[model samples]
Target: MPELPEAETIARALAGILPGRVIRSVTVLREDVVAGSAPQFGAALRGKRFSEVGRRGKNVVLVLEDATRVVVNLGMTGRLVPGPGPGVPPASTHPAVLFHLDGGACVAYDDVRRFGRLRQLSRAEWTRWSRQLGPEPLSRSFTGRRMRGILSGSRAPVRSLLLDQRRIAGTGNIYAVEALWSARIHPRAPSNQIGDAGAVRLHRALRRVLRAAVGAGGTTLRNYRAPNGNEGLFQRRLHAYGREGRPCHRCRTPIERVVFGGRSAFFCPRCQPC
Candidate 1:
């Protein structure tokens, strides 16, 4: 799964190769790969120049010279070939679409599960959708006070609150557990119970965890990679997550795991007391 860090890494990696590049052809290998009619989707982007490529939350955004913007959501297994393109990955790669450039190079979207979504949006439309997203955790607007305010009076568990995209965009299962552990907060603690000091600690922990992960390329548990096909190195540095029953890195206490919201939550019981 390409969460915010993965998506952000991809955007930066692709920006080095995509911008100013002219599209020679667009091949929507699957009808569903492109949002609307595959033919129409290709026609709109073909021959256009890529002005900018970026990320908003977990979405990869492409700004065309003609002002048409394309947003790609890598649902579960969607992967993009950066730079000079991936000639042709193995058949098991599940290639979904292709973007051929003016040169012989080409980029492709390979999705094993086909859960990703692609959308074409005008400036106004894209802005409208962006407005729906909550404050980016990395942005200056998302401070500890803001985080506390968002969590105030919420009946949801702190873990569920962290997973909420509307409160903090880009934080998913992996980072949420890790951040909670780093903050020494129980995963199932009530959001309302996280007092002022706890809120500050949680906010700082979240930002620190995300920044470090992004800098290290991101955590690759499954199908994640940078646009250039580089696997993330952060998994090796993870303090929690996927470490169930293993000794905690700091406390030597056995890390416990729980199933919530269809995902596993890993934490050191002694470090993060209820």
Candidate 2:
């Protein structure tokens, strides 16, 4: 799935090319991908100019001239590609929505597994959708105090707490494992068991790993790619995730993989002691 960094990268790239361009028309190739009525989505967006692009959690928001917004959650394999000309070939193997722009450019929303969604919403509606999200990890609002508060009473594993979007937006399994490993904290450690000092360390580690991953254009373990269709470079810097049996960078201990909540977590047994 395209996590925070991947979604943010796509939003930044789209903001550069999509803003100020008017939507000539919208085509819903896969009806299911359009969360609302296809006709309603098109009617609300046709001829409206895109003013800006932003991301909340793992979703992308396209702010339109009319103050209405288009939200896209690229669940798993969704890809948005900007094309050169009118009637350009679809970018994804299975495109869900295609936006024809007045400038002769096109933005294609493709999802291989048909799990992604596209919805048109008003500003109030957008607020409702975003209200449940926790503080952005990259934002100043996510302080150590806030982290300590969120994890203070939870019996859930620290890894599970990190993955909760309502507590810390934008972290997924990949970054959670990486950050926990970097902090030398075992994934299975109960959240409440982590002291304030430990929470601070985990908070710093989360910020560090996320910032580094964003700088590297996000990790491309599966279908994740930059808007320009390039793979991310952060995978090369991975220390624990997906490095099962490989020597740990800090302790040279063999990395191990364990499944928690049916999700694979990688860690160094020696470095990230339970």
lDDT of each: 0.85, 0.89
Alpha-carbon shift of residue 144 in model 2 (angstroms): 0.8
Q: Alpha-carbon error at 246 in model 1, in Å? A: 0.5
Least accurate stretch of 10 residues (summed lDDT) in model 2? 84-93
Best by TM-score: 2
Q: Residue 125, candidate 1: how far off, in angstroms?
A: 1.4
Off by over 4 Å in 1: 83-92
**lDDT by residue for model 2 over 1-274, one digit each (tens)?**
8899899889999989988999999988889989879988887898999999999988888999878989899998998988855666645667789898985778899889989999898989888888888899999988999889888979999999888998888999999999999888999999998999989999999999999988999989888877788998899999998999999999899999999887999999998899
Candidate 1 lDDT over 1-274, as tens digits, reads: 7888898888888888889988888888877867878888888888999999988888899899877898999999888874343454333357788788876667888888899988888888898988887789999988889999987869788999888877778888989999999999999999998899999999999999999999988889988877767899889988889998899999999999988777788989899987
Residue 170 of model 1: what lDDT? 87
Model 1 error, position 61 (Å) = 1.1
